[model samples]
Target chain A: MDVLKGAVDFVQNKTKVEVNQRDIEKILSALNSTNHFWEVIFLSQKPFAVVRETINYLISIDFVKTDESGNLILTEKGKEFISANNIPVVKNYTCSCCEGRGIVFSEIKDAYEKFKEIVKTRPDAIVEYDQGYVTEETAYSRIALMIKKGDLVGKRLIVFGDDDLVSIAAALTKLPKEVIVLEIDKRLVDFINQAAKEHNLNLKAIEYDFRNKLPDDFVKSFDTFTIDPPETIEALDLCFTRTISSLKGAGCAGYFGLTNIEASLSKWYEFQKLLLNKFNAVITDIIENFNHYVNWNYLLPSLESSFAFVNVQPKLNWYTSSMYRIELVKDVDIKNEYINCELYIDKEAILYKEN
Target chain B: MDVLKGAVDFVQNKTKVEVNQRDIEKILSALNSTNHFWEVIFLSQKPFAVVRETINYLISIDFVKTDESGNLILTEKGKEFISANNIPVVKNYTCSCCEGRGIVFSEIKDAYEKFKEIVKTRPDAIVEYDQGYVTEETAYSRIALMIKKGDLVGKRLIVFGDDDLVSIAAALTKLPKEVIVLEIDKRLVDFINQAAKEHNLNLKAIEYDFRNKLPDDFVKSFDTFTIDPPETIEALDLCFTRTISSLKGAGCAGYFGLTNIEASLSKWYEFQKLLLNKFNAVITDIIENFNHYVNWNYLLPSLESSFAFVNVQPKLNWYTSSMYRIELVKDVDIKNEYINCELYIDKEAILYKEN
Candidate 1:
């Protein structure tokens, strides 16, 4: 069997994770598409650093070259190697109806339409709290999915942060017994409460910081909760533990979004371990690129390393997150504590700043 | 707050998993659609017994009734309760394009059409080894999904069994470097080898029972493996350990099918724990109802306790399973030895009998 030993050696040298000749085959097949670098990253689904360095190694070896548009194209040598090795260029053929999320919005079109109108007066996403909300359709899908999972009707649902305004969407359906939002942003809290009063819905938003401990009433009072957790480990710990503490007992469920752009696979391993082992929850669903976010105000000068090597303007809608649904198998008892976990300004930190 | 206290008590009494009122809310919400009993099982996604008994409790309370056609319909009391509780009838709005599986076979239609023709002479699914295979589209989807995940090309692959004939499908794509199938049924092994020889594909099949230890040549010789594991814990342990033993090392990948119909949430918990904790792997994706199976010859007398009350001829095409994708995070060391685990005769074991 033929082997690209040098490229394999380079990938191994650059990263500790073992990338064999087969792994290199994936990179070569991806480049065969001559897709944009951003699309390649989406295709490869590896850490940004690993993909970048592997591509660099391929370019140095002249197996891959870049066109004026900065897309990767396989050279003659690369094509020969791929043919010799029997590598095929894999394309994305996910369902176009729901954008491969498996959940659709047709059943809830009226509710989504009303939700689109309701969010017209919604508070804008501010960078102070690392805010970047999903499109109105995504927020609406969350409502439908929760109801489909039997998690919404007459269930006390809580939202950790309200930048997405999902709590308002949940209230619009009048499916849940109560919809509560605990927002660190006072502007969002006021705006949500104003909308609740106008629609006469059983939705309430409280102005509370994540760093502070929840009040006694808020602890152990919810049937379900949803949050787009902060990516850092410290922040994830504080937010997830707080959310777990809010659950009434076992058999409860929760939904959250995790992104590939920020968290590495190792980080994902840690996150899954935290949920399955430490908290006694089982992950039922993990749909990649399910949550589509509108480009935030902070994208112009994005974090340095995400696409720092590329000179072209980044593509939109690529900064998406996977939707995760987990159910508690056993009753959870967690300490509600204050955490001073602040966002550190790093290359992978997309939503946070020095503040 | 109005509580379905009696119903909750009945469900908690029936099961030790501690089903709460919110869990029952899911059952009530499911009945709001007045769907068939089989469809309710799909909608609620709880264990067959839990859903069945919960429905029994609802019927006793006059909240629900069955129509002449044996489909569930909400009575006046049930409708009143739902209206008062603000419960909405949740519908399955999964992407019709892919039948809610998030995968499409449009790109591989040619290969699938060819597979369709090839499988016309495929060996029949007999019950001795608990043999039932997925639909052609599902088998076809597996090939496409594996390629989409960059798991196929230039990778040495293995299939623990050949009842589904996915190995033949993979070989037809000419994507993998090598494909090996170890099936206990001699008829299947011969059939597969014949097809491989006819198609001139790099595929091999050996007749080997799962109870035997792997040969030296088969040990530690694969980049990827796929299996639809037995439902029992002992069988799962043996099959998974054997499959894991065959992996080349860490960074290797595996795919498997798990079902909510046969396996309860607790069983899924144990399965996930087995993979994530014991095997040192991380689950990357889990799409529910991804594997749609052709009704096996063993369905008329499918193990009791799964819809024993529903006297209607069992619904077609409800025996679906979820597709799970997991990757090794660390090098795995597992025992490869003869296992005495055999099929246990139980209500949950749909594929196995006292052979």
Candidate 2:
């Protein structure tokens, strides 16, 4: 595959768009956003020193043309290249009722409620104390929200940790091409697998540990991955690395749940830096209070004794985590850079950190 | 200033982080997103390659250290550099009820309603048949939505064309550092300037035509600009270039409204390519149906006699346009590239294009 193919297919006799490194970069940048052209030209090292060369390259390739006044126009070839490549353009739309504010997507709300009703009736699954489990509403919304974000359009998806059963909710949509859940808990693995089978969904649960290197077969094999990572910097890094490893390439996306309640602003700052520095990924969307955890009344006893939850259980579970969607902007291969960290953080320390 | 400073600052007797281009890029990249990083990265070209040299340069400068595991960690100097730079991070949290979905941002709704109530009382502004004015609700929401997006936050803003009075509504917030409206319509200029004075809002409207080069003082002087250019490719290109010309630099943003009714997907596709090819801008968001034009009952007589609207008044304002937020990702100077085009289009032909 020619890296500079500019999202064109070569037919036996068709002259392909003569795309160069900058042109390819330009096209990829265009796919990222119809408006982010300035950013693409300025942020990356190409096209500037070679401005004349790049412009000439585009014109020479018959992808673009300049009218008498030098206003750039896309040639039919250029337009065809863009249409054929189907470059993903960043969507500027939100729900009309919600203005993408999401409150008005009551249909989603209803679906979430139904999803929760079903989840409540399911057999009791082992609750991992360290991996905070969200209320069913939040879990269902997480799935619905991912769908809204266009992450599950018949694309292969990998859930790094699915104690939340997003996999089941996603399967309910029957949208993803494949759904694979990697979990350390045998109970969850069995439960999710059972649900997928019962629903006849394109989903599978695999027993996997984050501490081990990601399976070679899984590297760069999926379009998207979702995770609720341990809130510690070390654990967060591990989850990110694993998620990056599983992603197909640039433009591939990952969703993760993070809480300000446990992770302080500094932690957020550090983790954000890590994503950009290591993966060249940018956080595209951050939906706040997107995930509200179910009050894990049973886990109180397992908690660090000093945990103030040691007091009375609040009537309502107010714990909520923000959902983040990070998209890679360039071709980044960090499979070897995947770091291993304890999947479970010290609950007591995290609770204390919250305080 | 050294471009390789790596988000650090100079302190007397303080050891500077030995930062290479990559390290500096890593830090700058971090700063941009935590606050709109993609825009910063796209507008300027850096942090793309030159890896070995960049790394070696960093090591020689001593801004980072590599662990035996080969993990690159920031040194004290590097950390100091990042701290000193204090790059803005992207905000992830939105209103809880709205979930940043925007349903509950009622203050905007209220402001919009109030603006509409007031607008209705004003004498009918001369209806320019070529420039469609949206319904009062659509107009108010445009202003309110801009606020929701943090575009009006104490930043110098330019509205390239404001037949919609978005500048007046934006000024109503009393949040912007400054708001300037440039328009060819003398009626709009006088009306908006009067509104700003009456409201004691920091807004100014000047009678300026798009056909002329942007004022020299205004070049790269504003943080953001908004326009609703004519649907034709020629007009869209002119408005975009003028908007780019007015932007301060990378990380600045622009907003425009385009409709599927008048602009076909082909037009959309061509215009998008032009944005990337000419301006290097990236579209961050496109909120659909955000602008509903107030039906111009008066323009029926002036519209092409073939226009069916010539027969009967449509009760509903059927025209809706998507609002797009395009941010500069890199440093871009389009002062020279700004083009001029006829701002008006043949209504009948545009409607025919839609079919």
Candidate 3:
């Protein structure tokens, strides 16, 4: 049954709120249920007299009231009581038609089939390696978590490398004031736009290869940005710099990169340096570490370049697979102390005194 | 080795910050490494090193930076450069420690043993049914998601029912102004308090039975509240009423009740009626018919109560064994529309409503 309509019907019947009879009938029919006497109904071709008893029982307890017009209504006292109390109305026991799965398996199957077909055509797409396409389960759960936390609201955000993850998150999140997407791949940009339409999401997607220049208009406007660029340390570094420039003071960013153990270790250093240099934003938490195959050739040189810039030491290890999430932030100030940068140049020396 | 200290050490080295030789030597000794070079460092023992290197590399290529004194930093030009440029970082290839499975079989066995002990005492206390005790894996993932979403900071919240989930979520959240827990079970309250201390979290666990009157000081103070009452509908109603009274106008509340489909439905109806009568709050989402086990006895009544309240239909269903997270908000007039309470119910209903 259309759960929403069913809810409306239940509210109407319980609260004595006058609603269209046709709407009630439509809802009942959708649920494949037929009303018998006053409150009794049959479901799944089985008569259920208990429903009537329960409704009558509710009336007896003064929880519900019926008007002279035969419209069910909560009593004046009941209404006031419910409002002040902030109570939730029971809508339905279980959606009989869907068995409470929310979506019909057939519909899901069809969507999955379509998703698979689209994936099949893109043999080179990295999504195919990790379950073909993203599921609402993964996307919505992540989005809901964000909303609950307040991260997706009122933050200037940028999406680096438009993909299912970013687009889905953007679509589901409560609209931030501004949402910017940097996409070098035209096909991905078009796909993101189409998906946005389907979801009625407002996101500004720009087609620009991040390896070059960024749009001049985006300087210093963002508060939070996400980086999930192509797998290469150099490219990652480039993306980091551009996004960092557009952030407001104390702004934060997140990145999800694909790297091997050595590369992951190497990129970790680069990520830290970028965070420290740009916003002084600290890495608060690491998200996850999972495995997938993505081309990393382009990122390798950037990784090498980043290695030359800063020195790093390992602390803790956690992983599910090859990929990992590392949290970082701008370095904290310690009194008025300063370190000599030249000390890092002597790689062979274990000890160097500050001059 | 202590993870936090290790991180501090790695950052110190990577940034070329001056640290006493003793401190560096101690850190190295703890990590079981003799070399200053990060690349040759043991993978399992040096996460701080890995993260430092990645950040440093990003900084070196002008992706990130640090000042004369070795403090990790990100440059504004660097931020603009990365996103605008579309840089990518190398992916981690393998699990340095376990090689991929994330945990050694021995660790799994040890965890299993601990789980058995926990289950022997309180079987239902642990979530993720198959897993015995809470694992870092589950905790970290949940916490990470919460952080990304922004649920972790700067909000005033109350948790109704102190349990492992509530306590853990509160602890892992980034930062909040305050966290108040209302628990009926005194033992649970004690447990929560101890756990909070262990985690160094600032959480207050108050012992208050919902069946009794609410403390006057708590009226209309909370911005968000989570309700997870016992399986009894009667108790549920009392708890719901008290919780509502404590919420500020426009505040949201989430409830996770037991499964007595019929009773739940009835209770939901009553609850909604109460909300409408009192705060004019509306139900925004409902998840029923979840894939998890349903405690039919409690769920039925809860479902019934939830249904009879709102005109708007629920968007989601809760049929699974997983706990339900419902969102609701108090309805307010922003543009001065004459939302007549009289139109919905008569003056008699006014008696039951709280101002």
Candidate 4:
């Protein structure tokens, strides 16, 4: 099959990234054993772009094909190639209880129950704002993780977005000195504020877009900040610059959620470098598949280009993001300045069209 | 109190590391709230060196003092500095159940039970060999975590040391293609080899030290490797060079445990940079306080040099290490070389005497 040469050729022809045969072979080995598109990212640890590019290359060479039901299937040629290479299929071994997060909500059972009850009236996610709320368990788990890290409780916390109403969950503990949420959706803002007042919690919500600079009083004033940032490189840059700018100074903490389904590991690599090199931050924790979201309605045939590859519905809530906790070792230099490192764009959507 | 100038002078006179006002202030603020040497690192997110230096400086000026019971106390002047600053005393909010590890042994109940039973007869730790084993729960948790990461099943695995017997636990699962342990202590080697025979497992142990060059056949031969390395910078560099050299190529994984009590954040920063810049490895998971070690006898009267700060014995097993999982994105260049990376040194021991 000359798979090595074929993969090398495909990388040079189709992508800007320099593809390594070993990485490609690794992904190919994992894919050869799976027929579920939903499980592709879970199967291989390679970057999202490389996996997608490899699958695309396989499709181009008539080696693998997507079923009408959204499942993956190897073509006869692909089967032959895999057999010739003697690739063994490895079973997925992630723990089913914690879902590979290595954490559960046992310690925060009361908060889990409370968040679950309060989120019943939470606003629905809208495609316009690129919003998707996490499960209530995830919401409470985030609160628990922060408290465990000593970033919560008697600390001033700022949440970048409240789509998940994580701010409300944190305030429920009545531990933090204050809880402030800057969200673009007025519905969520009003809902969170209503909840805060009714519960008499030290929390408030302000309707704010992340692209705009934070107010002077808000900048450099928080002990910790949390956000589910957009996946695009530009948007991620802007979102982080704005959110991180709110930190009082060094020893401050920030929480972020990055997804494997949308953001490639290359994007993760870039963001990680940005955190360490530019911001002088040390990443303390990253738990994979930690933030599992409620399946939103945006991808149900409404998003034609994205859903085209998946002709049918996914059986599970597969949109999960890794949770990150980072501490700034140096003060951010810029504050109260308009920040959009560049215009935020959704390149994955662009890839959808091109592919 | 002129605490700012005090810290500035202290940094200049006491340490080689760069000191920033914001970082020192953050540490001071968090420290003003607590008095336990064990709690110092957890109180603030600053690097270990800065935290240590700040505390030492406080003692120099009679701002902080140690109680005979080992608790930290503020001198009359230190009390004045804190009151003038109005620094809030933040309560420790770590989850009591998980102890901030996030994951419990709920899912691996059977494996947890089995590992606990088997490790009962394991070799006792000897400080001369830098040996201290983790709790049974921690040993099983490492196995479960690796399985959750999809790095165990049908993959060749290697262990740099066997003091923890994590290799034995993985062999218990009967999942890996092969499990090999390179350990320095023959007691551990014989014990693990004996366990392999009794359990009918595909695992073998060889009495090997990390400073020696890896055998040719062992180089670039494994899919995954795990270790609890010595925390000195030189030891860390050499140990990583040897263990990482055993990986097959890109997509290979490594697991390591780094203790906060021994290694400072500055060392952590340097090691992290080595992983990213030198080897092109991507860190996927890092959970703090994930490895809780059993209290060994070495810290009693036998280790007076390190225990000088504490007159009384500890009430709990305060020694813990963070767990890390990293994946290689590129192949390592060197193989089978006597790699000392500058003869392995333990400067922390020297610091104990000098301080």
Candidate 5:
């Protein structure tokens, strides 16, 4: 289920006109009759009391406002908010099966309840685990840690995937003063927009696939980038290169790596090598076995090479599975630094100074 | 750049070998020589000094020990410590380029000079940010987190990837644990094995592909499972389902969602719904945008329903691009467990039970 934040934003930012209680009620009535709203309500088939409570909640949240003519109009703030945030405004559509009640509309509620209970009782003892994706929680903590470290504030950011945790984190953390979310899925663009509106978060969700050329607006518009492209290393490589081209001097980037599984080891290594060749970022942090089921690592690296100058550092975080958090920074000149000392318990610490 | 923890665990659990300085050195030497090590070192060449310092610091942590035979080994206490804690033994390899100098042979001195300059300016930046598949520091933290969470205790864990983070996390976290790492790259497998021998970790690195059926021995032999399969979600799903079949009742599993900007909003919804339907798990947490450069999301869900008759509360930690932390715990049976009370602040203090 989608969060109501987008809807809230839409109402708050879009509707310019004032709204009253009567207008609110009319909107509620209209919503109740809408195919989309009816479908959801019917499917949930929660008590009418719950539905009424939800309606009241919507009104209380200012998602619906009244006009001077006593008619319900989405506030200008709400409309602007929705448009800016990319929240979906569903049009007329009806459920073919349940009509609006959402329920199957059959007399099998008891049977359905019984079946659900039975299913709930049967424990799914199977545990299938794979290393491909990282957990959302780990992703958030990693970013939070970066913020805590002061690595991600006010940076021009470009994201390669719009549907995953990375996009959500960007929307929530407010790391990049400006964030451009690029996705190939139109539906995801719509969904992300909707979600953004609900939360009143301002982000640019662009519809573009990595396999194709990047949007013209994104040429060299970012100092930091993240490439969590599709699994095909080739695809990842292409996306990484494109992102690199758009990165300013000293820009950094992060990418996901394959775990140490027998099946993925070779490709994982190859992917790593490819990244090194394309970017001058340092591998700073990693999340090991993030989800208990997926044994994958995230490579956080910063850009620091003559080819594409960017000073960066990597960040790491881990969770249950072999998941990793990698962070990279951009534009570091590596010609003046040196190891100052070596510490050994028995021997005096040795110091080396740069000449 | 695999962690030494996996090797440490293998030696401690699978064999009766004691790990000492020599063993540690050997593992380190092997790691230094591996392509993975070289990759990391090469990527972070600018921060060579810092990387060297970090490595030395980790070696001095006291958790790593060397044997009289000059083989790096965990002390008896160390073995007991890791085993008791269920930490995976990681295998460290030596650098091949500069014979552990962490420099490319041709430009050893020049690289070192360059490294000093870079680190001096950005002392806080991690040097080996993009080396190998993962980093050692991240691996250790991941393992420690798992041990703290009680997920690694006496669990039969299977890891699909073999990066430093996974190996180290598995080796360093928890005791009395069994771990199997699957890899497809033969070179890495060899490097990992050598590292495992040197560190005395009880981990076995195998070679296999998920496109083919899983090995027979892996059918139903695990308590906890981790898979970081290749990027294909379908492949990841199949691998997860197959692995889940092997887990015991109530066993926990984690998976990463392969996300990208090309992801359709509908697909994102469908992916979550699919997880809920197949696993009957409560999506407890998520990590939003990891970086503005990638659109990835991590989903953490607890298994519920009756398929396995086990009431499993799955905890999830997600890392996102934007560095936002989104933590969620499954709220189950709240009505039956707690009473809500309301308090008034205006007049005399008053309390009222909710519902």
Candidate 6:
């Protein structure tokens, strides 16, 4: 038992200050009397890893013994060892808030509710068009909070493909002076225009297609843009480019919905690189599952052959998109345009290209 | 209101089949009765982004009007349009678990309690040596869960450093066939060795310095390894290389702790690339704030003069580390050795160097 001998000698001779403390005798008496070693272990705040091994070694050397119930009892050698050595006591560290997770959002519920009220009036998704609409409560909550946080209000906002109709939420706030939607769907554009006119809201909509160039009058006209583009890289890149094109200059903000269900981390990495390095944008916020779309049953019929899980038709609406906010960190080099970045990748493109 | 007229015309003719459904009449009646448009909106489950604007436009065109208290009251025109149009109702999508974050650990409490019990005997950190030990509960929880998940049981486990004494925790289970610790601290080595002998645990410890090569017998001999190295890239790289070398082969598991407090996402990206591509490992799990270290007051004295925030002595133990589990996906090439990686960047090291 040289290990125990060395530890005892170290405690007795090396830690003179601790050994001389008035609390040593009381601690020894407590340790000798306790049937449950865990109470003593807890009091000492020494980890289970260290204390268990120490106890096992001491017991092996006949310094301690276990009762019928497996509780530890100090033998004569243990009593003598305790009297000679200085025991270390450490406080238990506990945080009731996050249970040590560190990331605690205390007022998130209040905030979520508040935002939900603000976006309650937004549009319904057209299932026939592969439109997956998030619940209005979540939509309003996210958008309203962004406005409350001063991320959206007062900015000249643009909606790239306003299928989600976030422009209406922005307009209703009367926070932003102008809200415009560049929509591909004629019906939605017409519907939004009629709504804006009736409410006397500062919102307007114009028919636009991603396949075409940006209208000259709309280019670089907005201070912020919100988009819920298709997840394919080609479509995402194109919509992202259009959103960037619509921004007024550096310091502008852009919001977009991206889903992990369709876009993997590698895709996210590439997109982030494009936004950060190529476009000089800095991502400031990423809210996971900020948008959970209602059942997209129409898309399922088309996807069922490719995705067996779709046939299950579980009641759960599993599609969710994370909301991201990126702010321009440097002046936009308008000359470095990527508007023509492919909006569709051909199957032939899958083949590895020659260097 | 040409927009409203066109929308009505398009909705009536294009979606006649949906409009004729018997549910459409029930939805219209529900819409007409409720002052809360969100109810109809929810029934429509159409996202507020798309719906609100359409509603606002319809209201503007005198198709819907607000009652005395600002609640929507459908006009005769709105009633007429409702019968002729197919209204989209999107259902609210919510996850009872995780509030829609998608990752839920339901039995975390039970698992946590079990681990807490397992690690109750571990040692307190020796703060003088910059040993900011995590709570025994969390360490035990994580390690035990790993074992329960079959990541450690029946495997030869290696711990790069035994300051946390995870090797002891593993050995106590008698689950792992063998547990070895390579440590720089002599006291810990002696302490672990003694505990192993007394408990008849299959565990061993060898004192080793960071600057030296790992002993020949240990290399490529382990089925799993765990390490929590310093935050610096050089230290992390060196420690990671050593841990990788101790692994048996492909399909082996490894766990390590890294913190955002010191390592930025860019640094994480680089390290992930090295693991996924260079080492041919796949990251299986990442639990944030999985390790919460106690206050490292000893190192504060050295850092206090350099950092202004130290004077505050914040009550919260703000330091946290995320635990990562990686599994070998293929044979490790081991070509990119980091045995001599610079632990600290020297003045001369800043100069540009050609490979």
Question: How does chain A of candidate 1 score by TM-score against the true chain A?
Answer: 0.86
Model 4, residue A38: what's the lDDT?
47
Across B97-211, the per-residue lDDT of candidate 2 in tens digits comes to 4333343335555566656755664435354536667666555556555554445655688987777888877777666779999988887788888887776878898888787
Better of 2 and 3 by TM-score: 2
Among the numbered candidates, top DockQ falls to: 1
Two-chain DockQ for model 4: 0.25
DockQ of 3: 0.01
Per-residue CA lDDT of model 5 for B1-355, tens digit only, reads: 1234544444434222222222333333322333232222232221222222223333465533433332334445444544443332222122122121111112123422332332232112121211123223223323433332233545566766443325434643324267776665555466556545655767678875544555667765664555433322354355545545545433244433222222212223344443443533323222222221111111101111221101212121111111111111111111111222221111110011111
> What lDDT is reached at residue A129 by model 6?
43
* CAPRI-style class, candidate 3: incorrect
Q: List-wise, what DockQ does each model earn?
A: 0.59, 0.05, 0.01, 0.25, 0.01, 0.02
Task: Compose the digit string of candidate 2's lDDT tens values, residues A250-302.
Answer: 55678877764455333454566677657767555555455667656544455
Among incorrect, acceptable, medium and high, the docking class of model 5 is incorrect
Tens digit per residue, CA lDDT, model 6, A1-355:
3544444444434222112111222233335545455454333322222333345545667866776556667888876665454322222222223322222322334544443554455455654444767665545655644452234545578888776666776677566768889887887898779778876889999998776777877787887788887765677767766778777765467877776444534355456656665665655455544565666545435433321221334344545666676666555654323255444332111111111
Chain B TM, per prediction: 0.88, 0.65, 0.43, 0.87, 0.42, 0.61
Work out how many backbone clashes candidate 5 has. Answer: 270
- Model 2 alpha-carbon drift over 4 Å, by segment: A1-100, A103-105, A108-111, A117-164, A173-189, A198-355, B1-114, B121-129, B148-150, B197-200, B262-282, B298-318, B342-349, B352-355
Model 4 lDDT, residue A277, Cα: 70
> Per-prediction TM-score, please?
0.89, 0.48, 0.29, 0.81, 0.28, 0.51
Model 1: fraction of the reference interface contacts it also forms:
0.69
Better of 2 and 5 by lDDT: 2
**Which candidate would rank higher by TM-score, 3 or 5?**
3
CA lDDT, candidate 5, residue A281: 40
What lDDT score goes with residue B14 in model 1? 62
Which candidate ranks first by lDDT, i.e. highest?
Answer: 1
Question: For candidate 6, what is the TM-score?
Answer: 0.51
- Tell me the lDDT of model 6 at B335: 38
